[model samples]
Target: MTSQQHQRAAGKRAFITGAAGGLGSATARMLARQGAKVFLTDIDGDAVATVAADINRQAGEKVAWSAPQDVRDEANWERLLAEAALAMGGLSVLVNNAGIGSLGAIGAIELNEWRRVMGVNVESVMLGCKHAMAYLRDAQPASIVNISSLAAFKVDPDYTAYNTSKAAVAALTKSVAVECARQKIDVRCNSIHPAFIRTGIVKPFFDKLGEEEATRKLVRGIPMHRMGDPDDVAYAVLYLASDESRYVTAAELVIDGGARAV
Candidate 1:
């Protein structure tokens, strides 16, 4: 392998949540291609299994594993981390990428709906960090990448719940980073904020407003005049997951195609 590839998570074991498709699966493929052993987990067992199988096939090695996981469940986090560490021999990277989008206005959003969004988007980050800390600490020079959304900084009335939940993730990521640093742990925690990545999460928008109009509206908002690809976010994840970012923690990397700048 090239020196750059070696520096980019070679032999590192990573556990990623929401690995069935989109950004999660894209990140998994990127990491495996860069020589990382990844544990891909999602609520959909069969889908995640297929993702893992595909990654292994592409890499021509057993570079990935898959398991059914509900990120909101604390016990599930514990079990998956244990099993992943055992399977990969150690844990070095944790990617909190599982989340759901919201379209309800704050006043119109039901209590249960709000709680559901917070549970999956906000609380799951906490659960994963809480359970994975020990393993990551043990594996020293570890990294935790939480996938927040640009909605954390930017806001919309229609995304009240999602925006609030992602903002919490950004805050939690900073807190974890500070604590880890104070403890002299070689673990780094960071969050990635991507806006309008062309993932399944944005399909609802296209469905509601025809594809052309939806794309135009989204592109108009972004200074770059285009939506982001899943691989764009995946490349960012790979950097954070790799040792190349050892000194980078408590950072919020935004991949929003300049939308946040405006």
Candidate 2:
């Protein structure tokens, strides 16, 4: 018997978006290690393939898979999700983690940029929820983990588009959760709101200014004076994706480094 046979997920099959790197990659690795089959997708085909290969190599088994995806496309969502479910047996968990930031404030932002941000951050979640509902319904007591942000509740003047998109994700999670409950589908939906994590979109800052300056600039606003690790949010995602959170639906789990408290 292998370690995968120990089975914490109890035959959980997860489909994760934006899994080429950062939180998505971390969550995928954690889930695979904890005995779940993970289907990873990202727009960057090469990167996601590498991620899947590394996971399989480390596990000594084919526990992870990957594909290229543009989350904004409805047609591709239908096709890829079905493929993922077939590949992994069934789709019990869906993580809507693909998102991007806005360039400027409300007054300065271009409409095209706003639309682009909304398409990736907000519309993509809606598509995932709608398309994955049937598969999750079949795999009773399943979960949909949407990656929102603290910006949804915390006001940031320069990031109006990003904030609004995250807020929509939070609201969308609640709507899907209630609908599933009412329909007696046994599928739970929730959102995770993280603040200034080391990975995600903030890694670019580290590349530009180097670690020290980047860390200092980002942590100055947080009460904890530190950024969160990818694993911090990954652990939250693992909890939400498993049966341990059976009774938890439409909940917003904040993995902020005390930033919201201040």
Candidate 3:
């Protein structure tokens, strides 16, 4: 099929958090190219603006805008969603992609660290789903894609806080999905679980261990024998965001390169 014919998100309005880089930026660009009007938000206003400009330039259209958003704050979530809806005319896709990773065993993890991880990774998803429901429902055939991690299922000794928070995200996605279905909201919620994608999130590990050794160790665990690119997860997000996934909800799209399967 021709590229234009493959534009699955044509005419959709998408709002994505953490849009400054990594998986979030990739998803934004892909959706824009697929003919979606996208609102990109991140705590780093300048970075997100740069991403938006880049996407618009590449697409040769005014398909994207950027905003500064702090997803952990409920008030901010409400305000941002309203602004995003206004900017995009209405919202059909909500991508709760802003999150942070923490590395510490249970005994060594500080109370503040646990709380921080939970607030960003878990509570942000809750806030996004709760606040964005009205716009999504009104828009109809809407999708909410939360970015969880394979760490949710495959626990690591050093990632106690991260794993717990992401697991909560997965559970929360299902709960939201079922509630929307029962209420006939016409809004779908799902989570993406990615393992060892070459994003900024993994840079710390590479810095701690040598890059070569870190890459080797990470790849060794994957049955596919490779680390994933940001686009790998982005394509899954695209499928979930598009109307093609209308029958799909409360699903966990794992982009782990067979790491979990193994």
Among all candidates shown, the one with the greatest lDDT: 1
Across 1-262, the per-residue lDDT of candidate 1 in tens digits comes to: 2355354779789999999999999999999888899999999999999999999888787889999999999998999899999999999999999999877997799999999999999999999999999999999999999999999999998989999999999999999999999999999999999999898987987999988999998888899999999999999999999888989999999998899899
Per-residue lDDT tens digits for candidate 3, residues 1-262, read 1177778898799999999999999999888888799999999999999999998888887889999988888998888889889988999999999999898998899999999989988999899999999999899989999999998899998999999999999999999999999999899999999999998987987998988989999889898888899999888988999999999999999989889987
Relative to the true structure, candidate 1 reaches a TM of 0.97
- Worst lDDT run of 10 residues, candidate 3, spans 1-10
Q: Please write out the lDDT profile of model 2 over residues 70-184, one tens digit for every residue.
A: 9999999999999999899989999999999875888998898889999999999999999999999899989999999999999788998899999999999999999999988
Range of the 10 consecutive residues with the lowest summed lDDT in candidate 1: 1-10
Error of 1 at 39 (Å): 0.2
Q: Which stretches in model 1 have alpha-carbon errors above 4 Å?
A: 1-7
Each prediction's number of clashing residue pairs: 0, 0, 0
Question: Candidate 1 at 11: error in angstroms?
Answer: 1.4
Show model 2 residue runs off by greater than 4 Å: 1-7
All candidates: TM-score:
0.97, 0.96, 0.97
